[model samples]
Target: MSAPPLNPKAGLRAALLLLLCAVALVSITAAPAAGAGPGSPDSRRGDRTVVRTEQGLVRGLSHGSYTTFDGIPYAAPPTGPLRWRAPVPATAWQGVRDATRPAERCVQMPAPGASGVTGSEDCLYLDVTVPTAEPAAGKRPVMVWMHGGAFLGGSGSDYNAGRLSVQGDAVVVTVNYRLGIFGYFGHPGLGAAPPFGLADQQAALRWVRANAVRFGGDPRSVTLFGESAGALGICAHLTSPTAAGLFQRAVLQSGSCLTSFPRGALAPGTPAYEPFAPEAEVQMVGTRAARQLGCTEGGNEEVLACLRGRSTDRLATAQLMQSFNRPAFGNGLLPEAPARALASGRFHRLPVMLGTNHDEMRMFVGLSLAAFPIRTEGDYRARLTEAFGAAAPAVEARYRAADHPSPALAWAAVLTDRSFTCTTLAAGRTIAEHAPGLSLHGYEFDDPHAPVLAGLPANPDFPYGAAHGFEMPFLFTPFPTERPLDEAQRTLSDRMVAYWTAFARTGNPNSTDAPPWPALRMSSPHAPSVQSLAPEPGGIHPVDAYATHQCSFWDRLSR
Candidate 1:
């Protein structure tokens, strides 16, 4: 599982020791990435697919309505000596570079049934999708996406943004940043280092700011959007001073500044989850991790030198990669925890849309049900006690097992309300409270019959209604689903594309084609209006998120 190997670079000042050890990693040209479907090297290419970028010219694939350019490096590969430092500008290349295929994903934890860790450190690349009709410069909006894989796995190329580009008339840039230990690891030798993955995202935005016009996009109209870990990364930027002016609008789906999990949310006895960690705590963990790696013979610089020289096979173990999934605060990139900053009104003043799925935790609970079944009332009550502690009875009273079809479903609902739905609503409310004049919108993807997605093993008893990440295919075309969308779901997908693109273009999601989505009013005497998104007739309407999700009760419990 060790994959934290140093990527080798040519013609750059990589650490001296790395130059000797990792030369083989760079010199040997590998075969094309497996599963590089569609726009493979065998795909058709033409002059129309070629575009000049800040670095050089790259040729993509032409798909009539849209064009795609993949594997364009946004930053110098964070390999060898440059592993943990801030991303450096990509080196310019000569002639036309072939960009019809994607690079390796950042080193990651293995997939659901993989043999070992997959991906490479030399993976800081981005992909662009441009509508052919809007090829004129500065004519369309720009969307920068950050993929969601708990910050451990996922690649920008995995998502095909053609539907969003052609239908929404926007230029979409999906980016790949460092992941897991390679991205989030911290050490005392590094004095208050920013999360490399987040820094890579900003670097990509800066790339967009400088190069969007060439791709028929308006630089000033950049919209930052993502789901799950990607959405959480956007939350960090909402409060980051370095990220100021990098984007104008933000859309966070199923994650927020306040998103945290209680104990036993994932499995029985699992510790609570917080997306961000203190720098000191991360540094301490890093130091301990370094010692465990047998790099404890000297001071910070010497230990760092030893660590940098280690082979990827030595560092990419399951333990090391999973240990540093949380980003750290108390640094220039983040002055404080994003939740603290958001609560104190320190985030960027811009239009924001944040929401969660109606059955957000079904995906999680369904995945773990095989190992830790919650098949009975006793099982559900024990979980409630572990998560809610002294308030278990009250929470149970509010979300009783008899009210649901099964105890497992009841447990999923409790987690959805406590961990994701309520936290997202709270973050949205606090934003409204701070900037009453600014646009703040909330939503819930309320479709109870969404297709099984993301390769989850299915269970007949537990239906995975609109769960975490089920909304992705609607936003990006060709997302992996067990089956294609139906007539009504396809219509809903088109409307959602319009809503998302309209929000990107004008900071409002409403259009003449769909129902009106009003901004939330946190100060109102009654509950705020949160748009509920679904495929059924009369489904795409507003609901009282605070009241429906029982947020007031959860708020009091937290206090």
Candidate 2:
């Protein structure tokens, strides 16, 4: 077979140049974030409070009893020649730094338009929320959260650490990293490289290791938790040597290492798998961008220099599309697929909590209606074949509309199984097989009152229906007040806080008041398996969610 494009220069240049410039404007639009004073009697535990970090003294506020410090630089901004290189430690700062407001988001393909927050290359920053009582014990468990946006878009600032900080009573840190081509494109000139996004995460973890003590946190007790792309990132860290010892626990919600959608890896029925764009392709994009700005040929270095000198906007478009900005292979930090690493038993050994929401793909399908429209059973079968091929017929037989309440329900079930449930279960089982001693726990979030985003259709009874990312608001602080949960949801949210906090405090999430959550047993002979979190008169219990989805067939296909 012909080699994968040695140079993805054309696609990279076309994709990156448009996004860089378009987001530049948004970066400039954000009002500078302000800092809150520490030890001030006014400090409410749940509000923001800027405390001194090893890097420098800073101010923040208290939300309830949790203190939040936002936009603390963990790495020197990747700019100029530093672009595409692994992150460097941030320079030490003098006196107190104002960390009351969030910093600029990392440069990324925007949310389908030029209207959202603009970003920049200088965006390796993190926010931390710690419990006020942390100092009494001299240390609290730390939970580092990675946000999810398909490896392209998301912000640490978008998440509220109130629940984890005040309720879980842990120090919660959220980070912003480079995204799209700006984060992952590789070139020969770049030399031996690390995945920039992973590098950014490591840098933040390093920062936590060096500085968590100052915030009354035990660095060694860090738990890395993330959803979606963030969860995938946690999986990458599980196998990255450079990330060893930085965290002791991990929580992956609704994303799996084995579920990567490889682009042009190999043709169906082909024996070989390769990347679509290799080193040469990446350099070509850089070269073209240089030429577009009137740089000389053979001036690869000069071209990159010129491109960097241009405004971020000149390179990125207004819509901030992401057709060509997915993860690249061969970076040292990632080296290969996460699934392969786990299968090889090369992953970090630690307590792991992995799970998925009930309906993961509804958000994707509903948002991208034109791409995943389902008008009939025939159409559904065709889509299933495209997703599962030889296994499609078997998958259909198990998830037929006759079994589902309706066609829409059937499609939702199929998407949920293929995209999330099966994938998460596979990850848990793999971890169990490869890392025997490590405790492995799994869960399913089944909240029917989850919030709907602006772009999605409003469902009076079941718009989001335990959909992907629906459980977030219940676990974190509610933003955009319009979407606040009702009394019933509030009660459920409180229960989630109890369960998650209990999990972070102890290896297990079991508590007298909290509902029972059983540990996943790969060799179990019982019917009840995988803990299910639902708001009901029956309360949380162990249910066979896998059986409902015909996971037996999926397991065969996966093998």
Whole-model Cα lDDT of every candidate shown, in order: 0.82, 0.67
Error of 1 at 465 (Å): 0.9
Please list the Cα RMSD from the true structure of every candidate, rounded to 1 decimal place: 7.8, 5.7
Q: Can you write out model 2's per-residue Cα lDDT over 270-368, one digit (the tens) per residue?
A: 112221234345455544445555656455565556656766665554222243244544566766667777888889998888899887766544443
TM-score of each: 0.91, 0.84
Model 2 lDDT, full chain set: 0.67
lDDT of model number 1: 0.82
Clash pairs, model 1 backbone: 1-316, 2-316, 2-317, 3-316, 4-312, 5-312
Candidate with top TM-score is 1
Q: Model 2 misses residue 65 by how many Å?
A: 2.2
Model 1 per-residue lDDT tens digits across residues 56-148 = 998887676778889999999999999988899999999889988888888876433356657899999999988877443447999999888
lDDT of 1 at 372: 78
lDDT score for residue 117 of model 1: 57
Residue-level error in angstroms, candidate 1, position 218: 0.5
Question: Which 10 successive residues of model 2 have the least lDDT summed?
Answer: 262-271
